[model samples]
Target: MPLPSIDWTAQQKAARQRSIAGGGKPGLTRMEQLAGKSGREVLEGMMSGELPYPPMNETMNMWLLGVDIGRAIFQGIPLPQHYNPLGTVHGGWFATLLDSALGCAVQSTLPAGRSYTTAELHVNIVRPASHRTGPLRAIGTVIHGGRQLATAEARVEDEKGQLYAHATATCFVFDVPMA
Candidate 1:
């Protein structure tokens, strides 16, 4: 069955407005400012504009929406630039969205002075997406957070809750180096 129509332009506009209201802009937080802040706190800072959002988000047409203790939510707008030669959204786009959500989900669980990097990632694309797919959301939740490793899973769905892709990631957790 066809998914219900969505006013994606309005949705994107609303999201951008919220980001702007919160002080969000594409940039990176300085390590000095990040020192002693927990992962969740850092994410909160980015959301509220106390810290700069990642520049990659602008390039990919995606941004973080929210974060919790061990979960992260992100939204993306697929455009022609993201399409593969086959005339649909490229799998790399799906993987990038999922990776961001999954990595942030794991990061959300880390304590101050700790960080993580994805050691392995597995993505499963269940449905094809295109520019017409509208705004899709990726919700990521931590499966496990340990001293040395963390695992997370994420799913990408449209506004109507139709799944397009799902992914899992294992991240290597380590202490952040102080300079």
Candidate 2:
């Protein structure tokens, strides 16, 4: 049987709260600050269609579901240790964010019952993000969706909108059996 699902937002929130409560050191981590933002929740809600998207004139910090390239966006926060010794955001962070955004971009295209898994991923880390770079945004989209594979492209930008990384992922779809 399929296992019980974990609520992503709730789980992340509780974990952060616990870490803060434990308190070996003080101050909210960068990821924590970004994840706790109301804009972040808005993005999640928009993806689930719980919230209606804004007008074209509306400028939102959060990612909106099914947005065109102009306004499309998705954000992610990694653990405190997600950075390199130089205190720069690691490539792995970009990998995960690109994976999620690319997969979710495909997910937005899927019909009910049919899901997808990443078949292959390729990323190029052009630069790195310092603490000053703040959180990160991985914007992704389906370049092409074929019968067997869906192609996606993603760009990872720091808070300043600097292009830190870019990637392409191919997702294989699971074609559900018809009743």
Candidate 3:
């Protein structure tokens, strides 16, 4: 069989468009735009390309696929580069996906000028993921959102709904200065 191919052309085009001359704004500048909007609005903006996608997501071949108040979903593919010494998808990939989803779920509950950082994360790898796993999704939902803290959980599953990993996280919420 022919080796599978991954496409980077579209992502490259988007990267170029995110350059300063291409109308890309810096993170702080963009956050200013989110100052008064809801977290859901900010996340939607990111998905729609109105805001810059997080560099980490791009680097890891993950993207924000969907979001709503107190919920978020991300999609990623396990690639050859993600393999560990044991020849399976690295645990870090699972952790990253789970953390991202959980944090974003909390983020989706924030008001403008507010942000959050993962204070704690607990992950359980239920199964191994390989490149053949095809597309995987990490779905997150917020369990609690207090003034200074938020808790959320997430699961990484394949298209057929087989769970690969699950995680829970607590995030510290804070306000950032408006642009």
**Candidate 3: Cα lDDT at 118:** 96
Decide which is better by TM-score, 1 or 2: 1
Give every collision pair in model 2: none
Give each model a TM-score: 0.90, 0.58, 0.82
Instruction: List the RMSD of every prediction in angstroms.
Output: 3.9, 13.6, 6.2
True lDDT of residue 84, candidate 2: 72
lDDT of residue 131 for candidate 2: 47
lDDT of 1 by residue, 82-154 (tens): 9999999999999999999999999999899999999999999999988888889889999999999999999
How many pairs of residues collide in each model?
A: 0, 0, 0
**lDDT, candidate 2, residue 169?**
90
Tens-digit lDDT track of model 3 for 1-179: 11124343343334335443434443533545676777888777766667766767656777766688888877788788888999999999999989989998999999877888999999999999888887777889999999999999999987567999999999999987644
TM-score, ranked from best to worst: 1, 3, 2
Go through the candidates in order and give each one's C-alpha lDDT.
0.87, 0.57, 0.78
Model 2 residue 134 distance off true place after TM-score fit, in angstroms = 1.4
Candidate 2 segments exceeding 4 Å error: 1-72, 77-79, 176-179
